[model samples]
Target: MEMSIKSDAVPASDKGFYKLSWTQRIGFGSGDLAQNLIYQTISMYLLFFYTNVYGLDPGVAAIMFLIVRIVDVIWDPLVGTFVDKHDPKLGKYRAYLILGGVPLTGFAILCFWNGFSGSLLYAYITYVGLSMCYTLVNVPYGALNASLTRDTNEITILTSVRMFMANVGGLAVGMGLPIVVKLFDPSETSDLSSSDSAWFITMTIYGLVGLALLIFCFTQCRERVVMDKSETENVKVSDLWLEFVRNKPLRILAFFFITAFAMMAIGNSAGAYYINYNLSGTAGELSIFMGLGSIPAFIFMPMIPAIKRKVGKKGMFYIFLITAIIGMAMLYVISMVDSLKEHMMLVYIAQFVKSTGVIVATGYMWALVPEVISYGEYTHGRRISGIVNALTGIFYKAGMALGGVVPGLVLAFVDFNKDAAQQTPFAQQGILWLVAVIPAILLLLAMFIISKYDLDDERIDQINKEIEMKHNNQ
Candidate 1:
């Protein structure tokens, strides 16, 4: 089959390599910012909310997390194929920014509502619905990057801006969430579990704001580098698996996504527990500690282009991954030493170091997804961006599944108690394992997985040029 480019669809200037304006880039990035605002809240706090506020046992919640991800394994690829084959009247990929974002916001808010309180069925419905809606938005939004342009530098810049905006949402949820929930909660108690109403209201506000951002993103993004209608019509769900089987870089990148996301999810879910039990910290302190996890983005994300140019991609990953491990070691040592426990500054410093590594290493990995998509297009003569993103989504969610399962199972083994004001030493140790030791191991594995990815910036650029030449000759 021959792939065709719509001669009249893109401007002459955008023919060979498309370049977007500042407005367009930010508009495109707002889609990520929006998803983070809604989903990051779920990732970082939903597990905590289920056990503490929503009144589920840690083991039960862990099982539910696993189930939800299992559902996604079936759901994500279907959403991907649907997005690739259909070009909506509003926009090809961007239409989902509204179509999916609407229900996603509703389910996100409902996921925090306590009317059902301890009802496991209600929990399954809302959580499953929320996860499905998120797939609808996430898979297409990911595809929007490759749909925007073929320029390698432009895609890099787009990924940088997207990650920066995404981290901003992370900071808001991490730092701002507890404080906002506090203001909305009527009780004076420091425990987050007692404030169900506050959690619901806070999610409502976040969900609405997230939906608005998705709309703005819908307005800003246009599909410029998509498959032709004829090519797209032949896309299928099996193609997702076929692509994974054939695409070596995609397979390697898929493993990296699992390790990277698993690392983040495990660490993020454990932060509140660590601060509350391990450190005997207050809500204010929890906010600062969690906020610091994303604060490094402001400092280091801007330096990504320069960092990549200086160290090259692999070298940068090595540096940051090592930096994260060193930070985790500091935390473990600080917790064990009697003299060091009292110095909050030392803890914060360790967090900053650890976060710098994680934020840079995990953040830049998004840039690689587009490269793998280009690789698929180069090999198969079709740009099935949605299918590629879906495949990556499955692996990343598989990583998240591990993230969701480990902490809960470990907590259950140690007899974690939500009703008690403080945990046993064994439980505290489990939280530490979740926060420091386990995540550090995953980062090590991520470093190894990324090493196997063979697509360099130069190689991807060559692929894009060759595809363009084939289209022109047609």
Candidate 2:
């Protein structure tokens, strides 16, 4: 308690809370940027790598995806519990920025490797290892947000900085990967020699870049408002469950994470398939389509503070999510129509429109975690960041798993072929739905579920005041 407080007078550090050092902010933002390079690469490109480059049957690949998600159900909680329990000497949560993050980079590149000839063993090994390593990094990183500060405004600024960096990474992958891949794929020869080389080369670049960001993240970030010193005993599994059961905002947020990410993962993974077979575009065109999905973030994310201020967080969500649904529906209609303009041009517009809504809406959901953590602290007099983060971690990973499993299964049901230069008409249609309609429906469901979220400006401010009083009273 003495160390936490220099005096009864608020320190200049606390007064200038809204302004974190460039290094601290970039260091924090870099972690998510690192994650996007690895995670976003997988989300955007894994299915294509699996079916075309890795040589897995679409049906088998889908089953593998489902199995992986099922395994995640076990792994996410364990990572959460482990992160909550351990207090590494190097740094509490940031240690994983190096430890877990380094391995994550290696495994991510390997997942793109074409060796092993589509062996079920290969897909299971690299993908599962990558998922586990991601947990080690992700759970801690989620906890790190709560660790940074107790100030609501600081958290909002931090979240904004983080999302902006994340979108920058997203823009790179969405725009850059295909062009890079094309540099390798140069010819239309029906063999994956080019695709394989492209993926290996592209992933290597992203992975190395991510590794550098991890180093920066480790250097810059620090935990300020941690509750670790007050611990009577290590955080236990039961405590994790108890937090979810007792905290209303945590429960709402956890479910929200799952649905929202699942929607994102599903559409992103389907990009190569849908564009290749439906409009049947070149790698260059595919690059444009993916790039369009992320371009709006730069245009619109800066407006988030204003948007939240004007409409309220919950109100902003309702408006944007419904707008996104309209975009998705229009894209789906475009998919079904016979006499549309250049299909790529139409889809690029739809992606741009849909992304405008999806990027801002889901991106803001991240800032809610700290708010809920405050609510938990006010209610229980404990600030267990890891336990709280783990619950959110589970839903986020669950959504990703669903994203993988659903599109894989659907493509399998439609009988997608990786070996062929082209897809069956039915399979192409399925790919269209996988990218456009299925995700649209999921986004709609996400909106419905989020409508139940009760956390608002009034509740968040009250919780913050209560927690501030607790610290002051001590």
Candidate 3:
């Protein structure tokens, strides 16, 4: 069975799988880079900021994270449906880069503010607003990937570029942020918890840079494969669920998103605690350790297209997922050994291995999104990219919610004392589990979820061609 639709005028260049120039590719990729700057800071540091620096209770922060994500569940589809149904002068997807980004930057900086320190109301207002604004930009930016072109190979390259740029942002936040905070500390203290002003300054810089990159992205990306205005008028919030129910590949990708992001979120949120308490490492060592997590993306992301071609998607996922699990196990074992516990080099090596596997496997999953979007267009006669991305966003945020909840719960369970200079032995062990075992388990589950994704490159190419043919006929 197939769905059909009458088409409005689509350009000759847009009637078939179009090729994007390097400039266009980089421009589009920058949006992810921009988002990573704002969002990764939150993901990696927000909980620590809340409890250690801003002085919120771990349990309270956990509840806040869950609440924020629940709000996203309601908000994502509305933004998705609205973006699909409305055509703005700036561009369908590109417009949001500025429309949503400017405010996103403001709220992102505010999330780190110490003005109303320990105020739950302040945290809720700032974090919730930041998240909604992020959805406004992110759902559209994801849809923009599918709007670019239909060539499977091109999409692979584009996804690689995007992930590479994203990791660059991760590096800045992961490695550079602690150093930046130290530089800004008035007391010459390396500890971020000692100075709220430093956190605010660091985020302000990151947020402003992100805003500039978003503007650049808006200027560069052109929406090529969008639903015509008339056709879009029929779009409804219900289509988000409708597409999910009928789209098999979307289902597989959505589940994979949940597990994959959960792994990253858990590991990232636990990193500071792992370094500060479990490893007894200094802030500099923690920066280096976290920095290593993103560094491997540079080495591995560029090779993704060639690797995928050689190994096949499922094979690539299997190899990398297993590699990540092995790395996680190494981390757990090394932490337990007194001799290895003294060796920061060993920890860096383990982190490099684990991050390599996790980064490449998860990074390449984004390329699959366009394939699933094409599948939906083929089966449903509508290219509702925004709706599809919104569905994926919900699952990803759910995974993020788990990331936020698990670490906080673990800390609370172990009686982690924010005021203590050193964590209790049991608390240290809980941090170890958060950083290693928990994330490793999530990675294993992610492998199983991705194995269910059946859309190979060849099949997707065939679907794209068929969809293009239908558009050309109309």
Candidate 4:
């Protein structure tokens, strides 16, 4: 496919690269925060809630998680095609923040409601709707990253701010959520894990907050680098697959997204189970353990540009991905030692190490999305950001599917008894593997996949400059 650039189409100030204000950066970042509030909560706690509080079997919950992702496989490209093909007055990409956010909030709230608890029909309907609505927002929000600017340094900063805010949401869900649920439970002595009402109320509060942030994001972001109406009219849903086939950088990034997100999803989903069953920890400990996962992002994310400058993208991935594997190995060894099992401090330290590695490595991968989008635009002469993001979304969700499926299947295989005060030794071992070994394996794969990504910062910058010059000559 070819794109014709009309002489009148380029705005006088449209130089292909744009600089954004602090407010614009933060505004774009808040969209991720909003998403983490709704979706990250589901990723981290939904399985636990389904199995222990809502009374579904672990296997059943796993199937439900897989099914929702399967739906995403069908839904994401459609949303991508739709967004790319039409430019709404609100904004081509930004419009979906509100359009999708409203229903997403509703479905998110309903996903936690226990009124029809354990009903497969209720679970499927709510989860499916929630996942679809998420796609509407996520594909466009991702495209918005490429739309903002072509400055690699600026995109890095924007990605840093975005990940920082996103981690704040993760910290809230990881740390504050357990505390909030416990406080809201009617039974003062009973664990919040078993209380359906606590989950319902907590989700209601989180869902509303996510909606408000979505509005904030919509107000703050503006789309500058977009295809004109005539150019967009030629976009088709098949472009999602076509772009994946033709774009080498996108393929590598897409596979990397899958591995990175799968690693995160598996680790996050298994954390509560790991703490509760494997470590015999209390709610407060679980909160701290999970919260540690995000805390390091604040410290490390700001330094990403500096890190990449020194190490280059591939070198940075190699360092951090290996660090993550080492941390996971430490956790496994610590868990297996009976003497170390009672030492909570050692467990906390290991968790901190593991989280630090995971947080920084996975956090930086998002910055790659816009780079790949630029590569595609350079090669194809049209910026099909939505289609590219859709492809990445599919792979990431595929990773998430493995995350959801692996833990539940492992639990079921080990004969994990959710209601038991203490699990069988085999069950504890399975949880340990989920927490450490499996995620470690995935990280190693991530390291390999990222090695295949050839668009380093200098190369991408050159491509952006060339694309800009082409536009100028048009």
Candidate 5:
């Protein structure tokens, strides 16, 4: 598609800066790799860790997840504002790779430490600190996307690389967990009940790997499209509250991100329970489940740019949502059927299909943020990528909160006997619902919300042109 963006507004030099060198591309992708080890580790395993290792009841852990997100609601905007207001000597957003990343990594390692058995205070404190430190890095990294040039194609490519790495990291965490645990102790029945030695050792290694990635990502990433040194740093707290009211695209995208990530989080978090108790699968089954989750990103995510071009973003959402819904229905039905009860492969296949739709839909959404930030710049004349990212970060965390809370509440409500070797039938049904049905509903909600997303290609091209014109005139 031809773009009519005012060329004069974008300096000839800025166009070159839009695309990254191969080294830069690899460097940028590493952040997600790091985040996967840290953030995904927490999201996927924290509740399991709590119930199985830390000995917190599912109900209490659920409350703790909710509380952390509530804490995020307070920190997100403030961090966004802080980054936007200050001109760090190291860099705008990239510097946080070290500044915030070190603490973030340390706390992540500590979160898995089993020193304080049954200590809710330890769980709450470490998890909260890890989350806050993560926000300091994440909000800035997200803003870093907008600080790059306004080339939609380049941004799309960059987003693709970022998402690809994120999924790869996700794959490692999901699939690697069983492998990692097995390496430590091949015969442990439930990871929760395994020798505490195995769990602590496993997490320590993951924690160390996460720290290395954080450093690599920080060193590699640089903000290309920075602000004028003369630009005023004054940012009123009221401005962040106002940004939501005035920024319509951010509003739509933020809500879409929330619902979409929540769907994935909720579904992924519940899958282990469904497989273990509902399907009567062994630890070997985890490799298959984790594989299903990761493989689709490779299969489907690469097609996102092409798919977006062919069907338009809104049309693509509808198709994928339906695909996910069907897959989820099959998952629930297969698990419930008496004859099919032992055939876990059918459920795995359904999960594979459901994840194909979800991985693409959710992964591609990260590509859309730069567009919204561009729109914000065009409308408001301030290029505040950090603020925009923080808003979205708040929603993403909210999505994670749902993922964490829903399954916990479900398990708690069912009075899950985690201490038992085998779950009751009622508990098994609860696992099915948590794994398939609840997330399917969340996905449906996301699809409905995305239908209201009005950022068409033509409109975005226009916004870029206007932004360019503004820069030229300045």
Candidate 6:
């Protein structure tokens, strides 16, 4: 379906907002879906694979995770600046989808390969390579969102569709991966541990599929909103921080990204452990539990526009953030009580509630990035989409770093034993903290940070309009 607002006097760009066809929206969304298939798999299961299949120490893996993100802190902004400073012949933002996607796919597959099993150097090389390649795709893709159109409603719908498809990728990873790995290596039925060949084959399949999706996204996206070549002539890495310093809403949103992604990272990374150790679940059950984290997205994401309309953005945030905390509390409580823990239905219900909140709240935050980008353009007269996205990417990776580091550190602290049939009660308790207590605490902090966001819809619309009018006059 295509949506159009006809006005004889105005150019499409002069209108300050453009509506996308369904194909464009879905095509762009496929990029995210692809990333989730590749990266989300890493986020959720790589640590588990490292410890169980690849023989890396939990504490050592945690430090490697930290160092990888530190490298991102330096690399992301350079990618951003380079993107903003030049327009490629292929396409400004969309070009990187293929350029980066190819290497990203290769590195993702390599991350799971246990050829150098237990080799920390190989782990660091593959993991760091994958992380850098990811930023190469991620930063520009974020810029692509802002460049698509300035229409607030369009961006909202785009985000919804993007997240919906992303969860599709998440679901594939969560539900299908374990089952597929087991299909390949049925002899080792207990869990993913020591199933090295299965992990490699699974990642190879996902990586190729992800690369294909990136190609489809590249063909469909056409950058319509962007800074003029003259305006972007002097784009610099330092501008990312300068924008952060000046753009209050960006700062707030940046912090919110940190908390929200961290909350998700910690929970997602711990989910396999939570199910396998704490619940004494089977591989199938582990798939179901991890899959539930994304399942709510299919049900609740389409309602985001309505929810935001009725409650307003911040109101919606407050409602869902609190709901997530409640669900986490239920999870924590259930695991502590034997009777409650015995009923899988109750655990599934708690996961649904918690995921419903987390999915909707975090899914909608992507829309706000465009708003902040517009705010920067209004004030600075330069729509530095790449720089803004780089800034957000840095913080988002920081959250992911915490996700990667915290689980390993906590597992190390609790004396997690890969060879043991079952984890100690203390280790079980720590896993529970990763799944529930820690994420809930972060959601509370996210609520506080998001409350600081001052650019409501009305204000952002006006800013976009003024910026467009200025462009038209020039």
Top candidate when judged by TM-score against the true structure: 6
- lDDT of all predictions: 0.90, 0.80, 0.90, 0.88, 0.80, 0.91
Best by lDDT: 6
| Count: clashes, candidate 4 | 0
lDDT of 2 by residue, 262-366 (tens): 989998998877777777676677778888877888777777888888988888998888878887877888888867726567777888888888888899899
- After the best TM-score superposition of candidate 2, give how far the Cα of residue 36 lies from its true spot, in angstroms: 0.6
lDDT of 4: 0.88
User: Which window of 10 residues has the lowest lDDT sum in candidate 2?
Assistant: 186-195
User: Is candidate 5 or 6 superior in TM-score?
Assistant: 6
User: Which portions of model 4 show Cα errors greater than 4 Å?
Assistant: 1-13, 190-192
Candidate 5 lDDT, tens digit per residue, 1-474? 234343554554464236677677777878877888777778777788788778899999999999999999999999998888888888888888789988997898888888998899999999999999999989988887777666777677777788888888888888887678777864566432355666678778887887788788877776777666555366645667777888898899999989987888888788667766776676678767876887787777667788889998888888888888888998888887878767777877888888788877887788788888877777877777778888999999999999899989999888798778789888888888877888888888888888888888778866776666566556
What lDDT is reached at residue 418 by model 4?
88
Candidate 1's TM-score: 0.97
Using all chains and alpha carbons, the TM-scores for the candidates as numbered come to: 0.97, 0.94, 0.97, 0.96, 0.95, 0.98
**Candidate 3, which ten residues in sequence have the lowest lDDT sum?**
1-10
Runs with alpha carbons beyond 4 Å of true place in candidate 5: 1-11, 15-17, 190-193
Cα lDDT tens digits, model 1, 1-474, are 113344555553455578889999899888898999987798889989999888899999999999999999999999999999999999889999999999999999999999999999999999999999999999999999988898888888898899889998999999899899989989867755369899999999999999999999999988879888999888999999899999999999899999989989999899889888888888888899989999999989888999998989999999999999999999999987869977878999999999999999999989998899989989988899999999999999998898889889999999999877788989989999999999999999988888987788888877887788778778
Error of 2 at 414 (Å): 1.3
> How much is 329 displaced in model 6, in angstroms?
0.7
Model 6 residue runs over 4 Å out of place are: 1-8, 11-14
After superposition, candidate 1 runs with Cα above 4 Å error: 1-12, 191-193
